[model samples]
Target: MRRTTAAIAIIAISVPTVPLTYGRSQVGGARVKQYQEHLRTVLPEADHFVSKGGEYPHFRGYIRGTAGEVDKLVGLAYLNSDVGHAITGYASEIVVMVGLRPVGTITAVTVVTHNEPYGYRSIDLARFKNQFPNRR
Candidate 1:
């Protein structure tokens, strides 16, 4: 009886630990390293010149455009069926807003809005908000 209990405890502990060890080796470490290198390469060129204070740090002088200029602004699409299943009821569509300063410099990112049924109440305006003073 004692041996069985010991074995059960050992299995419980090892099961969670296996993911911590194997998962890190598989992709987590490599993904983190890649992101760090990517961020290092992109930070210098992006300009942040917002003087107005707010809940979050203002990232101004990034992309120059207005709210209606959705087509002109770059869009990043994450088309993962698994993510679709997890968040929304159907695996049809998912739109997440991410704040981008330049090609590589991402200052702040928040989920603006989603077509999903149940999620955040109000969209975060900051995600799509950009102040570009130099654009024509």
Candidate 2:
């Protein structure tokens, strides 16, 4: 039974399930605008952006329009986080919003939210996010 359960779990995860906004309660429409604003800090050249597709565990699909329809793509943006906590010990999810170039390199990453220790958060946000603009 254990082996069967494990196999089922693996198959369930391996199969590409059409992401139905995993945890709909967690991702709201507001996060779309939030991520778009975050994306602008990295992709000012995109000109137009829209997040209309479903959200996944770490991926958000969006439409990018640049230099007219000829240059277009249904880009997948990433919003992820490192786990940390405040002094009180509650889990604080740090959400990092990021976009990728067509070649699969990171274009930019913005730290969107966190509940880190006050002092550490105050200084680390900018420096940490600044590193991912052109990384792969």
Candidate 3:
């Protein structure tokens, strides 16, 4: 048997609305719920989130952190980030495939992905991520 899963992130981008492929409305409620549960785990400071669209032509999600203790907002987007290696030569063709792409606020500097060697923990602690959130 084959298994499949869906992820959702509440992002704040001004791009035009995109369509979702898994059907709209209550049809994929289960997957949305699942995404919410997992997002809560990854972003415990988040109070709640809102998602846009239902399929992949331009599916996106977003959440705000207003619990006082949390200082960042979250969004879902699909990105084709270039990946490089310490020993291997840098190549633009080497792209990081993201399954669940999480980026911080409007000007947010944080991002999350499932690529190896990208080092999520270290990246999270990097100084660059501390930049001010986008106010747009």
- Best of the candidates, lDDT: 2
- lDDT string for model 2 (9-91, tens) is 99999766543332333344544554567756655556555444343433334445456556455344655531222123234
What residue runs in model 2 are displaced by over 4 Å at the alpha carbon? 1-31, 52-71, 81-91, 120-123
Better of 1 and 2 by TM-score: 2
| lDDT (tens digit, per residue) of candidate 3 on 1-136 | 1222222222323223544322243223444553554444333445554444433322234455457764344544322331223222122122221223353433233333333244443333346444433433
Kindly give the stretch of ten consecutive residues in candidate 3 with the minimal lDDT sum.
Answer: 88-97
In order, how many clashes per candidate?
Answer: 0, 0, 13
- Best-matching candidate per TM-score: 2
Count clashing residue pairs in model 2: 0
| Model 1: ten consecutive residues of lowest lDDT | 74-83
RMSD of each: 14.2, 9.9, 14.0
The order by descending TM-score is 2, 3, 1
> Per-candidate TM vs. native?
0.23, 0.54, 0.28
Q: Candidates 1 and 3: which is better by lDDT?
A: 3
Which RMSD does model 3 reach against the true structure? 14.0
Ranking by lDDT: 2, 3, 1
Is candidate 1 or 3 superior in TM-score? 3
